[model samples]
Target: MTRLIVAAGGGGDAVAAAMLHAALYGDDERAVILTYAWDRLLVDPLPGPRGPHDFTGLEPLTRSVLSVPPQARPIPPADSTLPRLAAELPHTLALLDPHHGAQGITRQLEELVDHLTPRSVDLLDVGGDILAGGDEPTLKSPLADALTLAACAQTNTPVRLLIAGPGLDGEIPPDDLRPLLGPHIHTFTTADTTSIAAVLDWHPSEATAMLTATARGIRGTCEVRDAGLPVSLTDEGPTVHEVDLDNALDRNTLARSVMTTTTLTEAEAYSREICGFSEIDYERDKAARLKQQPPAKPDLASVLFRLDEFQAEARARGVTHTTLRRLSEVLRLGGSRRDELRSLMVSARPEQYVAPLWRIA
Candidate 1:
């Protein structure tokens, strides 16, 4: 069967969807992976979801059957993490822009159907946050996943909404998801977790990394993307669920609100008013502040000091580790010399727990 999987939440969800495709479908040759450019503001500080400007080689695709031209720019290189990581990956990458919102996504799905003629489409979210009701206090970034879910629910093709790794994103508590997914949840095979673990080595994603770590029975304190919080993943193995897509829009509050939204602005506005948060505003403000400042020169002392601050607050709040690179950016420090600092610090403190950039230094 021809299969197309859209990384419903972007970031690690794209990779997670690819892994799911390989496991469920047996081979990825028949699969086409679609993902958006939005990443954690901590990792990519861009103001808005990048589109044609951020990608390259779409001019020609824009010409041919409008085969959903790549929205990745090759010159300055795309700041969004997934496209850069796509090179080392074996999946065919397609780009989606939230600027187009659900209407644009549905159109892209139709165009992709024209191009690939896929028999099945799975809109995948790695963590169970996609199952959130929007009023959950822990829901951090619900807008992206909600937009995808809302769009796919409207599409004509047979769409399957799959959520793997419950509570991995740390956005929705497992208790919140378990009841809704009780009958729908299924287990991942040993081979599946093994494949997931392999990808963690290639693509450093906080959400997926935590999922794999949990699948391996890793317990105790670990770092996360937020400096003030370190997340604790229990020994529960990851749960993969197949949600009935026909009622997806009516099932979730956020999806229902954005189901009719034609523009990113309207969808974003709804998220702010209905969900009580606006990730778009948060990203834009963060990027604007960074652009206003001259980058602080990278230094060991300042980096270490910031690390200390991150860990102290994180411990106090019972949160996980933050990304070091993002923490570097948070300090207004340049990234070119981050590796040099990492090497030096690795030897200096053997006891220091490091999780790529997602560690409590």
Candidate 2:
């Protein structure tokens, strides 16, 4: 029987969903992942999530639902990793278009269920942000996850909410999430990460990278994202916990508000009304600023000096490791120069440790 796995917040959640499928079913080709084309501002540069019109060569899974093929490409001005993910992952990767809002997404999901005839539907969230109470001070992105919750609430199939790597997103604190999480379902083993190892090399997902690192027995304080948010990596970082779908909807005030939204604009308005702000607004502003003044070329000496300064402060706070993505931001390097930065760092400091994460020292 096939299993329908929805990547709740998109981006790295899709990567985590692939890992979850492998861990639970083990080489089963019956897993289908439905995810959004929303990525970080550094990756996509676009303000909102890319829809069907933004891609080429998408195969229709249903009259309303479309599946991303390995050959699919995002139209110019719209960037996405879904096409590459489809090529790398073993299961079919279907696009989750949120432009039409919660009700529209519900219809698409219902159509997909009817077409696939899957035995189970699961919502996989890489970080526990899907459980946000909507007022959490650290919550940065919640609209997409809330939209997914609201859409899944209307689906006929019984949906299971699986939260992996609690607090790894640096949104909700681990202490705050302890009371809300349900029974632990599975703790990812090293073998579980085998399918995503190659994908992580090029994927810019900070949370999923931390999750995979934790599963590989790495434990320490990891600073991730452009914000340099410090997340504590522990044994809990590799485990998946199930939350009741109804309970999740109850906790997510924004999701409840957008349950009947007919357009993406309406849903975003509710997000701002309930959560004080919408992530798309932040992305739009950032993208505009980047367009006004593109990132400057990094001076090797200045970059190394800034890195040392940042490392000193991070170490003082007990931070032992950081992702290359975060390091790129720390060094004032643009997304395009990440590889160049890595090569420079490696050649300059051959003794420095490197993997999915680089040693901060």
Candidate 3:
């Protein structure tokens, strides 16, 4: 059967889906992945799954390829996560164009299912926010996952919803996640460091990083994306819970609304209206500015200070590693600071370093 695995939310969900697949179904040559390009704009600035605007040229295949920027470097850098995944698990990656939302994605999945003709299609969410009831106070970034779910729900595909690392996304707290899980929950894997360390070794993903840290035995409150409040991810690692799509949608009010959404813009608009913040717009604009006016040459002292803070935070929370790209950008490293930052990243994991501040994840 051609099994399609969908990462409900973007960020590092692409890699997170792969890890989840390995844990649940082992190796399956028929497996393909679908994901988006929404990431922490400050942390990663690469454009996600190309929208219509991104299509310099589009050639469809089992795993499609659409042309990107020529250099995609200095101005408007391409997304960091997907290219990194392509380097490792090239064949498995299938990108969703962001220009369209649920209806468009539903159409795409329908075509993809006909092409792949898989017996089963599994939609995966690393964190359980996709199941949110929509009233959850801290829910952010629900649009992407909701749109994916909404699109998939329109199809006749036998979709199995698997959510791991409940509340790991830092949006919905674990307390709030339990009641929504209902009776359909089934646990397939329980990772405790040893079982899944290699998962991140190849596909180092931040989406799964919080889950990984939990599996590896980190505890207490952890910081996730500067939520302004503590995200309670340090508790339980994750139990892969399987539920029927209808059952899951029933539990999530946001998912239900998202299911009704005909397009991405509509879904995003609804979510932005709910969250009461223009966070997505702000992030998009910030990313745009990064391309047009790259930050000025950074100072070493301040850069080191930020690095010191980041390292301390990671160690405090048991995060295994940090990408040079994330670190340099967080530190605002430039000119001489860039080289100095590179030296530090190389020293930490020299065997896995790539140039231009590229780290494993």
**lDDT values of the candidates?**
0.65, 0.88, 0.58
TM-score for each of the candidates: 0.81, 0.95, 0.74
Q: What is the Å distance of residue 315 in model 3 from its true position?
A: 10
Task: Find the number of clashing residue pairs for candidate 3.
Answer: 5
Clashes of each: 15, 0, 5
Cα RMSD for predicted model 1: 3.8
Using lDDT as the measure, the top candidate is 2
Error of 3 at 349 (Å): 11
- The worst-scoring run of ten residues by lDDT in candidate 1 lies at 60-69
Candidate with top TM-score is 2
lDDT per residue for candidate 3 within 250-361, as digits (tens), equals 7665556666566556776777666554346666765676678565455555655665677667666655444433554566552224345555655654663422113222
Local lDDT at 275 for model 2: 94
If ranked by lDDT, best first, what sequence of candidates would result?
2, 1, 3
* Runs in model 2 lying further than 4 Å from the true structure: 298-302, 346-354
> Tens digit of lDDT per residue, candidate 1, span 132-200?
778887777888888888878777778878878777777777666666653454555546665445445
- Model 2, residue 224: distance off in Å is 1.9
Q: Give the TM-score of candidate 3.
A: 0.74
